[model samples]
Target: MDIYVLVGIVIFLALAFDFINGFHDTANAIATSVSTRALSPRVAIIVASIMNFVGAMLFTGVAKTIGGKVADPAKLEHGVEIVIASLLSAILWNLVTWWFGIPSSSSHALIGSLAGAVVSAEGFGGINYSGFTDIIKGLIFSPLIAFTIGFIVMWLFKQIFAKSSPHQINKGFRTGQIITAAFQSFTHGTNDAQKAMGIITFALVAANLQSTLDVPWWVKVAAASSMALGTSIGGWKIIKTMGTKIFKIEPINGFAADITSASVILTATLTKLPVSTTHVITSAILGVGSAKRFSAVKWGLAGRIVISWIITIPVTAIIAALIYRVIALFM
Candidate 1:
């Protein structure tokens, strides 16, 4: 295929990945609020969609990191093809996980896939080790940070509100959950949606269509719009898993989890690092659930979720590597 045509396909695939990410991961933002009856599913999806678009428009630092950190697009002869393979692998993993209602990390899938594709095209020496390790560190520690903060936050809430009547507390916190959910959705936009933008920017640079990793305005708009539309659809199965299955989340618990995870996500965005909203949010829920009652948390399910997180990188890496090899055959 011509370089121009391949670049076009890469852009299309990048946007498609963003769209899937919207629904696949947006559930984490609104699940707690919906579960606690703080917001109807319809209202939650609408709010998430609008906030995601707004959030996506306000950041470009992380997009730049993704474009150049793993490998220099300017140096790779097969950079565009690598992007195509990475995107396809990521998208396939996303769909499969969403179908099973698993709350896996989209960030890890994209990062791992991109790295694997780079290695396929340019060998292990191709990776920017320092940059790649930093991204990995960000991903690995974010959930742990969220868990610790969530535990502390929820514990504080419990102490502060202990004397209050349960009914009144639930009533007030239900309203509070609405704001936290919106904030969560907004932070999600700031981070998760930008992965697609970065991939598209990477393609542009690789194709020599642009000179720098700065995201183009049209690229930002297209990625934002694609994600917002996907957010509107909502991921019902994952919502169920995140909301009702994790634990019986009351309004107070939901509020704590939402606010904690949102702050963590926004912090990562400001630092120009990509973190998995899925892992952060889910870990927050687990931490909050632990604080609520250690015995109450379904440890079995939490263990299963942790397993998925651990495997996402290696699984997506192998998939993308194989994809690049197959694509290489024709070129």
Candidate 2:
């Protein structure tokens, strides 16, 4: 196949992955607000869709990191094919997880798929160990941080509102959740959507159409638009899992979780690190639940979610590796 055609296929696959990610992970952003009745499902989705677009357009640092970190596209002879395999694998994993209402990390799927595809094509040395480890560290530690911050924030809120009546406190926080939800969605776009941009930019470099990781304007617009459209579709299955299954979230719990997760995501974006919004948001909710009342949280459900997170990378890596092998047979 011509390099141009392969690049086109990669572009298509990257966009499709972005679109899937929007619904798969963006559900975490609006789940709390929708569950608490802070915003209706229709209104929340619309808000998240618009904010995700705006946030996606505002940054490129994380894109550059993703493009260059896992492996150097410039060094691989079949980089475009590797990227195609990665995107396809990631998309497959995202869809499977979404169907089962698992709040898995799209970041882990994409990053793991990229690494696996690269290794499949060029062996383990193809990986940039320092860069890959750094990215992994970010992914691992960010959730722990989000969990801690969520606990502290919730604890503070509890103390401050200790004298307030439950009904009055929830009423006030329900309104506050709207702003937090929008912020959460916006931060989600800034980080999550950039993975697709990074993958596309990686293909561009691999195809010799670009000399650098700097994202083109058209790439940004296309990625942002695809994610926004996907967000509009809404992931109701995930919404149910995130909003109500993990714990019974009151308006106050929702507010704290949204604020904590959004803060962690925004910080990661600014630092040019790709963190999983799914992990952070879910961890935040769990932390808040623990702070509110440890027994109230369904630990078994939370454990299952954690197990999903733990396995995402290894499973996606194997999937992408197999995909690359299959693609290589054709080439």
List the candidate 2 regions with Cα displacement exceeding 4 Å.
Answer: none
Q: How well is each residue in 95-116 modelled by candidate 2, as lDDT tens digits? A: 9999999999999999999999
- Candidate 1 on 143-238: residue-level lDDT in tens? 999999999999999999999999999999999999999999999999998999999999999999999999999999999999999999999999
* Global lDDT of model 2: 0.96
Candidates in order, TM-scores: namely: 0.99, 0.99
The regions of model 1 sitting more than 4 angstroms off are none
Clash list (residue pairs), candidate 2: none
Candidate 2 TM-score, C-alpha based: 0.99
lDDT for residue 327 in candidate 1, whole number 0-100: 97
